[model samples]
Target: MASALIMTGPLWFFTPIQVATTVIAGMNCGASTLQSPLTWPLLQDEAIPAQYSGKQTEWLLHGSEIIFPPFNGVCTVANLVMAAYCYYKRNDGLATSAIASAKLPYTALAFALHVATTVYTLTIMAPYNQKLKVASRKINASVEKGEEKSSATQQEGIREFRDAQAVWKARNYGRGAVMLAAAVANAVALKVSAGL
Candidate 1:
């Protein structure tokens, strides 16, 4: 997991940035492979029937929330700790030390990327998530009667649900882009520092 790699970023002092970047990039790649088409599309399909789609999406979002938050929280903590450690180590003596002098910039870059990813998730994804949760709760979960016309109010809720899902999916691409870039940057930093 990316969190584990980030947590260990400080430990890889000999090649911290390089290792961190490589590991985070690899994590991002793995996540991308799993999420796009594979996971999100399946979740989209699972929401059968116009009536239940919002609830299904809510369920899907909840499922994802359960998985994502804990890991992200851990990653956040790890990044913060590692960033501090990197700062301390850089200030202590690495600034003047020949081979280690380059670490400060790389370390800073990695930390900034990590922070950026967190910010992107919070500012961009979190609001949509909250809306989805609220909509799911407020919307009726029962199947609509086949003979009866869907109430205009019910239709509106369904539309809002679908719209939220669309918006969330669109914004997720941006988050993924940021993460991918972060991973790449981390990896590049590793290569620059470690020549690996």
Candidate 2:
């Protein structure tokens, strides 16, 4: 039962990251058309040559697309899996453990948060990608025209960044809650075992 919990916990947390990473990879494959200085806000300085600007934007976008998902996924998975193990061990003896009782509420809360985050990512973030694509096109065009393109990219970036941040925060909060609950459960289980 402990092992089962551990396995399920990690799987639940990491799956979202895996899916997000795949989506980013798909986006990067089509990013060649986004080769413009204005496509990325970080490289808008006049001192940077236009040629270098495009390359920088491409590199930054590619790196971000690859990195964020996997990093977030691994952290979340580890936290949840450890929590599951703790929770399971706490409840092994069941009847006399304060920790075991506490684990129930914590587990339920964490599970709910996880579900909410999943829904938001799928229903909201997935559709927002289309808007990002459109914004990318507009930014690229603005760059070609030697026009200031920060506004469009900034607006789009803000939206994407906010969505990503929310997902990440949700994962972190859920994981933390799970871990805390697990610790409490483990402590109670140990005490119960000692008394028995």
Choose the strongest candidate by TM-score: 1
Instruction: Report lDDT (Cα) of residue 51, candidate 2.
Output: 36
Best lDDT among the predictions, by candidate number:
1
RMSD of each predicted structure: 5.7, 11.8
Candidates' TM-scores? 0.69, 0.35
Candidate 1 local lDDT, 24-119, one digit each (tens)? 555754574356456656545634654455666677667766765554444445445545665565555543243334544654565676677779
Residue-wise lDDT of candidate 2 within 1-196, one digit each (tens)? 5434423542333234334333433333234223222243444455654434444544554564565445434434533553465466555674424444444344334434444434544465445444444444444555666666356554454445434433433443443343344334333322322333
Question: Any idea what lDDT model 1 has?
Answer: 0.58
Q: Supply the TM-score for candidate 1.
A: 0.69
lDDT of 2: 0.42
Determine which window of 10 residues in candidate 1 has minimal summed lDDT: 141-150
Record all residue pairs in model 2 with backbone atoms less than 3 Å apart, i.e. clashing.
none
